[model samples]
Target: MLFAIVSITMLSCGTSRNLDIERGTGYNFQAGHPEYRTTVFGYMDEEEGTLLEIGAKIVKGSLIYKDEDDTLQARISVEYQVQDLDNNNNVIISEQSTEIIKSTDQDISSTRETLDLNYTHPIDPGRYEVVVNVTDLNTNKNITQSIETAIPETQKGEYSLSNVLLDGKIVGEGGWEPISTYDVKSKVDSLRFVFQVISPQTDKRMEINTRLLRYASDTSYTRPMHYSNYSPSSIEYKGLDYDEETELQSNRRVLTDYASTFIEFKFANQERGNYRFEVRAQRDGDEEELFKARDFGVKSKNYPAVRSARELARPLVYLMGEDDHEELMKISNNDSLKKEVDRFWLKNVGNANEARHVIEMYYERVEEANKQFSNFKEGWKTDLGMIYVLFGRPWYTRSHLKELVWFYSYNHSDPEYSYYFNQPKLKNKFFPFYHYLLRRNNYYYTVQYMQRQLWLTGQILTRQI
Candidate 1:
C-alpha cells in the first residue's frame, strides 16, 4: 500500500468563506495474495456552488491479471456515497460506483501504473459525509474510507472568491486531477492553484496579490517568499505595479456578462510541510484588501514531531551511511548532534522536514523490529532485525515449524525473491529465533533495491503499507 498526490489549485467564495476543506483519515485496505498489495487515496471537493467533486489517485503494480477474450485484464471498482450529515436516515444526496479496468493484449509484465478518477454530483451548500470504497474485483477484497466536508452558504453584495482547489496534472479544459490526499511525496509534475473572482461590475480590472508561505508546525518560514515553477517563456509574478506587459498569475476574462475571473498559479519542486496561500484583490488604483486566505498542508502524519530543528539528530543512527554513521556516533553533545543531523539531511535530501520524514520512518521500522524480534542484543543489531529494519515489512511472510520465508518486491519486471531463515539450534536460548544463512547467493542487490524503494517515497514521500 502507498499514498500518491501532487498538485495544488485555488478556490474561493465572496461574502461567505468557501473552505473546500476535507480531512484525510489515512484509511487503506487490501484483499487477495498478501504479497500483492494495492492502496487507494481520495478526497472530496465542492467546485462551483453546490457542485461536489470527488477524486482519487491509485498506485499499484500487483494487480491480478486474467485472460479475457485473449487479453489479460485487471479490473477494480470505486464506490462513493454522499449523505447529509444533519440527516443520516438514508438521506443520501448522491451514491454511485465506477469500475476502472486496465487490460493488456498479452500477459501483464508489471502492472505498475498511476490512474486518476473524478466524480461529480450537485448538492445544495451544507454539511455532508462522503464514504469511498475501493475494491479489487479480481480478488474480491476491498477497503472503505470516509471524510466530512462542507459547502458554505454563498455570499452576495460583495466581491467574492471561489473555493481554492489543490489539483494534480491538468488533462483538458475544466479537467483537474484531484489531489486525493494532502500527504504529498516525491517531486511531481507541478502544483497548480485555481481561483475565481467575481464582482458586481463589468470590464473592471483588479489587481490580485498572491503570496506563498512555508511553515513548520506553528512557526512560519520567516515571512513569505516567491518562487517560480514556470518556464522562462512564461510570465512571472513579481510584486505590485502593473503595466499591460505585467501579467499576474490569473485568468482575467469576462464571464456571465459580469466581472468574473479565475486566478491560477503553478509551482514546482516544493518540499513537504504546511503551506499558506494568501490572495488579496483590489480595484485598480485602490488599496488592496485581503480577499481569501487559507492554509494547506503537504505532509504526512507519520513524522509529525520531527519538524523541529532542535530535536533533529535523534534519528540519525537509523538513516546515515557507514562513514557518516561512524562520525555521528562519536558526537558527544546533543547540540552538536542536532547540528550535524540537520546539515546531513538538508544537504542530501534538500529539505529538513523531508530528511526528518526519512529518518523517522526508517527508525520506525527499526523500532518495530526491536519489539518483534528482540533476543540477546537489540533487534536492530541482529540479522533478522537488520533485514526488517532495512527492507521494511515483507509483502509476504510464511512461518513453518522451524523456518520462516519473507518475500520482497525487487524488480517489478520479475517475480520477487525470498529470504529463507531457520533456527539452527533448537536448544539455544532464543528458542524460535531464525538466522539468515548466506547459503543462497548474496542478497545484496535485493537489500539495496528494497532500501532504495523505501527511500524513494520516504525521503519526501507519504505513508505506505
Candidate 2:
C-alpha cells in the first residue's frame, strides 16, 4: 500500500528540570527565536514488507549558520527509525549532513536542501511505526515527526499499482519523492505524478480513474460530528484509459507494465490549502479493484495574523463546558467575545500574568496547528486540531500507513493513554483527516484535565482553581 504520513509534535514543558529529552520528542513551538523547520514525505510498501522511501526538505532560511573560513555552514544530525510496536523490533537509522550557505548582499535569501532516504527491511507483516528526528547540532535545536503504517504480505505474480510519487519538474529523475505535506508558496506550475503497474492481467482491460478535490471542513452532512465535505471545481483531474491498440485514450495516459510512467499535471492559479488526489483502478464498468490516495497542502508563504481576541479564543471551544459554550455562542460580536474570553480565563485563573501565560500557551499551539496540520480547511478545525487544542502534545506518537496512534501519560512510568485515528473516506473521496475514537471514559478525564490547566505547561489542570 502507498502511505504518506507527515508527523508533528505539539508539546510543552514546565521547567528546564522537567524536560524529558527523547530522541524523537520536541516542542511544536518555542518561546525563543524561530528555528529551522523540516518537512518530510514518504510511502511504505507493505507487500514488499520493506520498501520505504522518504524525502525531506529543509529551508535554508530557517537554519542558523556559523562562520567557518568565510564560508557559512550549518550542521544537523538526523535520526529515523521504524519499529514494530507488536514485537518491539525496530530499525534505527541516523546520519549527519551539512549545508554550506552563501551570504547574500541582502539580509535574507531563500536557499533549501532536499534529501532522499530509502531503506528496506524484511519482517513479519503487522502494525509498524516510523519516527524521524532532526537536530541542529550548532544550536542543539531538535524537531521530530512520526507515523504508523500497515504492511500487507507481498503477493507474487499479481497486477498491482505502485504508490503515487510526487516529482519536481523532471519525471523519473527525482526517485519517488513523496509530497506528504507542503504549502502554497512552494507550488510550481508543472508537477508530475509517477507510479507503476506490475504483472498486469492482460486479458481483462483496466482503467485508472483519478479525481482531485479540495477538502471543505465547514459544510457538515453526516453522523460523524467532525466530518466535512470538499470544495468542487477547485482542483479536479479525471483519469482516462487507453487500450494497447489505440495507443492513446483522450487526455489520459496509458499504463505500462513493470516500468514507471507519469501523468503530467498543469496548474492554473490554484488556492493555497489541503488537497486530496485519489486513483482507482477497475475494469470499465466494474467496481474499483485498487484504491489509493495522496493528500498534500498548498501552504501560504506566511500565515495570516490572528487579529482579534475572538480569533485567539476560538481554539478554547473544546475546553468549554456546555453552559459556557452556550454563552459563548450567544455572543454575536468579536468585541463582546473578547470580554467574555478575558472573564472566562480570569475566573479560572485569577492572576493576570498567570492568565496571560495560559492564553499565550494555548494560542501558540493553535497557531502551530494552523501552520503544520492544515488540510482542506484551517488546521484548528481538523480532527488533529481538535485533539491538539484539547489535550496538548501527545506523550508519544506512532505512525501507520492508514492510522496514527497517540500515547499519553502523566509520567513515563504510568499507564499510557492511547488514542487511535484512522483515514476514512467521505462520499468515496479520500482525505488525510484522521478521526480519533475519543469514546473512552478515561479520555474524558484527560480532556477535562487539559482544559483545567489551560494556563499551565507540561502539567494538567484538574480543577480551575
- Tell me the number of clashing residue pairs for each predicted model: 19, 15
Looking at candidate 2, the ten consecutive residues that score lowest on lDDT are 236-245
Q: Write the per-residue lDDT of candidate 2 for residues 30-139, one digit (tens) a residue.
A: 42222333332233444653454433444454556776767666666666676765676655444444444456323332333433344444445445566666676677
- lDDT of the structure predicted as candidate 2: 0.47
lDDT per residue as tens, model 1, 1-465: 111111122221123433332222231423242111112222223233346666655444435667777667667777777777667635575455655455663434333244556666656665666666666688876666665655544345345555455565523524445444434432244666666665655454666677666542311111101112223232211110112222213333323435455567877625544455556666654564535543444431122223333324433443554566667757877678777765765576666667677776665565455444533223444455556665667777777766777777554333335666554434222121233321133334454455555564453255342
**Residue range with the least summed lDDT across 10 consecutive positions in model 1:** 218-227
Give per-model CA RMSD. Answer: 18.5, 13.9
Q: TM-scores across all candidates?
A: 0.46, 0.46
Q: What's model 2's lDDT at 408? A: 72
Off by over 4 Å in 1: 1-50, 60-62, 68-70, 88-90, 98-100, 105-112, 168-178, 184-186, 200-209, 217-258, 271-274, 280-465
